[model samples]
Target: MRNGLSTFWDGRGFDLLLVGIPLAFLIAISGSALVYNVVMSFQEVGMFTLGSFVRPFAGLKNYAEVLSDPQTWPILGNTAIFVVGSLSGQFIVGFALALFFGLKFPGSTYLRGLFLVSWVMPGLVTGALWSWLLAGDFGVVNFFLRSLGIINENIFWRSDPAFALWSVVIANIWFGTSFNMILLSVGLASIPEDLYEAASLDGANVFQRFFTITLPMMRSTIGALLSLGLIFTLQQFDLFAALTDGGPNNASNVAQYWAWQLSFREYDFARGATVSVMMIIVVIAAALFYVRSTRHEVRG
Candidate 1:
C-alpha cells in the first residue's frame, strides 16, 4: 500500500488516474444514455412499459412506422434545409467578418469580440429576442422593411409556413456566426505573414492573394468548421422550442424538436428514440469527418 501510494503520487500512475477519470465519467454519463436510447428504439415503449427493463420487442416496427408517416419526409426535408441554410448563412457571414477583422483596422479586436455576443448568449434569450424582432405587427424587422418599401405589409415570420423555417434559420445564423468567425479568424492568423508579403511582391492582387494563399491554407479549418456546424445545427432544439414550437402546421418542424414532441408530448417513446437514433447516426458520420479534418490539420 505504501509503494502503491508513492507510485500514484509520483509518476505514470498520475497520468493513468487523469485519463481514467474522464473515461469513467464519459462511460457513466454518455455511454449509458446512448445504450439506453438505442435499446428503447428497438422496443415498443409506452407509458406503462417505459418503467420496465424489457418490453415488447419491436425490431423494425418503430423504424418502419416513423419512415412511413407522411409528415416524416417533409420533416426530414425541413431538417435538411434548416441545417444547410443555417450553416451556410453562418459560414458566409462569419467568414466575411473574419476576413474583415483580419485587415486589423483600429479597434478591430474589440469589434470582433463584440460580435461574440450571440455565441455567449443563451439560446433561449436569443430566440426570445428574435421572436420579438420577427413578430408580425410590432416587429422592428417588418417596420424596417416597410420603411424601405421592401414589403408593403407586416411579414409574420414565425407563423407563416413559407417563412417560419427560414425565420428560424435566420436566428440560427445569428446565433452561430460568432463561433464560426472566431475559428476562421484563428485559421487566418496562423498563416505565415511571409506568404502574403511574397505574393504581394509578385504583383498578386488582394483577391489573388486570398484565393491562392488564404484559401488553400484554410482548407482544414473550413472542413473542421463545416463538420462541427453540421452536428451543432442538428442538435438545435432550444431555438425551435422558444421560437416556433414546430407549429404553423409543423412547417418549421425538425428532427430534434420532433423527437421531443413524440416522446414527452405524444407518449410515443419508441418512435422518439428511433428519431434520435437516426440523428445520432448522422452526427456520428459528421464526427468521423471532423476527426479526418483534424487529422489532416496535423498532416498539414
Candidate 2:
C-alpha cells in the first residue's frame, strides 16, 4: 500500500514540474517587460551629434511633471466617461441581445453567424466605416435624418465638441457589444434548466426570474467579464485613432490616446511612459478588487 501511494506521488510531482516550467518562463518574461517599462518611465534623453540617448537617473521628475500638468484631470475625466459609457451601453445591449438569441427561434443559427461577422472584422475597418457614416457632410446618417425632417442642418458628429465624445463612444459600443454577447450567452447557457423550471412552477415571470435567479447565479461570470472589459476599454486607443484621432479640440481624448500623442505626436516618450504606468496602476487596482470579490464569493 505504501509503495503504491509513493508511485502515485512521484508521477504527480513530475506532472507538476512539467506544468511549472513553462509557466515560470512566461512569468519571467512578463516581469522583465514590466520592469523595462517602469525604467523607461523615469528615462530621459538629450540630443547629441550622433543621436539622442537616454540619460540615467531622472528619478521622479517624469511622474511629477505628469501630476502637475493641468491636462491630467481633464484627460482622466474623459477617460472615465468613455469607459463607463462604453461598458454600461455594451453590457445592457449585449446582454439583451444574448437573451433574445438564447430563446427558441427558427433562424437562431443564422442570426448567430451574422453576429459573429462583426466580431471577426478588423477594428480599423469598423472604425473607418463608422467615421464615414457619421461624417457631418455627405454621410448616409445625416441624409436619413434630413429626409425625416429631424433637423434643418447636418449635425457635426465628428467635429462638434458636444457630439465628438459620444460619436466615438457610439462606435466603441458597436465594436465591443459582440464580445459581451458571446460571454453572456455562454454564461446563460451554463445555467441549469431545472432551476428555471422550478422558478416557472412557482409562477415567477420573465423579469423576476432574470433578476432573482439569473443575475445572482451569473454574478461571478459577469464580474469576471466586466473586469476584463474594463481593462480593455480603459486601454482603448485604436478606435479613437482610426475614427476621431482625438480631434476637435481634444474633446474625445482618452488616457491611451493622450499617452500616444505624448509619445509619438509630441515626441515626449518619458511623459508617455508616465501616463502608461499610471494607467497600469489603475487597471491593476481594479483587477485586484475583482479577484478579492470573486474569492469572497467562492469562500462564502
Candidate 3:
C-alpha cells in the first residue's frame, strides 16, 4: 500500500506541469536564443531584410575582420577612457558625499535630495543639456566666459577632439555619482557604532578609523557597487548617442556607438553584431574578474 501511494503521487500532475515543465522550457528557450545569436554572428546578416542564404558558415572570419579594422582599437580605447574616468570621478565624489551626509549637518538631508536630481533625470535630456552648455559659439558657457574676460570667443568643446571625450565624461560623472552615493550611504549607515567607539578609544583619528575599520566593513558593499557601475558604464550608449553622436571624426566613438553606427547609419548588421558580441565578451570577462576578486576578499 505504501509503494502504491508513492507511485500515485509521483505520477500526479503538479510535479510535471508546475515544476519540471516550466524549468525545462525556460532553459530550452534561453539556450536556443543564445545559440542562435552566436551562430548568426558568424554569418552576414543584413539590416533591412534577411536575404537568401548562400553560405552561412563564416566561422571566425567576422571576428578577425572586426579586430583587424583600424577603428576598432581606437573606439575600444575611447570606451575604456570614458568608463574609467567617469567611474573614478563618480566614486570619489560619491564617497565624499556619503561621508558628508553620514555626519549631522544643517540642511544635509535637503542637499542630498537635491544632489540626486541629476540621477533622476533622463539620460538623453542630461546629454542634450550638457551638449548645449558645451557648444562652441553662442553657448551660455562661452558668453559667461567672455563676460568674465576669460576668453574673447567661444570655445569649441565638441569640435576639439581632445575636449569632446572629457565633455561626455563629465556629464556621465555627474549623472552616475548619485548611484554610488546612495549605495555607499546605506553601507555607511549599516556599520556598527561600537567599532567607531572602539577605534576612538584607541586614539585613532577619523582618517585612520575610516581606513582601518569602516573600509574593511564596507568592502563587500563597495565591491558590489563598483561591479554594477562598471557594467552600466561599459554598456553606456544613450548618453554618448545624445551628446556627440560619436562626432568629430569618431573621436568620441565608443564600441556601443560604433555598433549603432554600423547597424543603422552604415547599414552593416553583420559588423554591428560582431561589435556587440565582442562587447558582451568583454563585459562578461570583467564581471567574472570582479566577482572572483570580491569573493577572494571575503574568504581572506
| Top lDDT prediction, candidate number | 1
Candidate 2: residue 187 Cα off by (Å):
1.0
List residue ranges in candidate 2 displaced over 4 A: 1-25, 46-54, 290-300
Residue 249 lDDT in candidate 1 = 98
**C-alpha lDDT of all candidate models, in order:** 0.95, 0.84, 0.84
Candidate 1: tens digits of C-alpha lDDT, residues 63-175: 99999999999999999999999999999999999999999999998999899999999999999999999999999999999999999989999999999999999999999
Which candidate has the top score in TM-score? 1
Mark the regions of model 1 whose C-alpha exceeds 4 Å error after superposition. Answer: 1-13
What tens digits encode model 3's per-residue C-alpha lDDT throughout 32-120? 76565566679877754445555456788888989999998998899999989998999999999999998869998888989888889
Give lDDT tens digits, candidate 2, residues 1-300.
997677558897678778989989987998787776687788773223114443666889999999899888878888999999999988999999999999959998688768766667777888889889999998788999999999889989988988888888888888889889988998899899999999999999999999989999888879987887898788777788887888777888888899888887777777887899999998998798679647866797
Worst lDDT 10-window in candidate 2: 45-54
Q: What is candidate 1's local distance difference test score?
A: 0.95
Clashing pairs in 2: none
TM-score of 1: 0.95
- Backbone collisions counted per model: 0, 0, 0
For candidate 3, give the lDDT of residue 240: 83
Worst lDDT run of 10 residues, candidate 1, spans 291-300
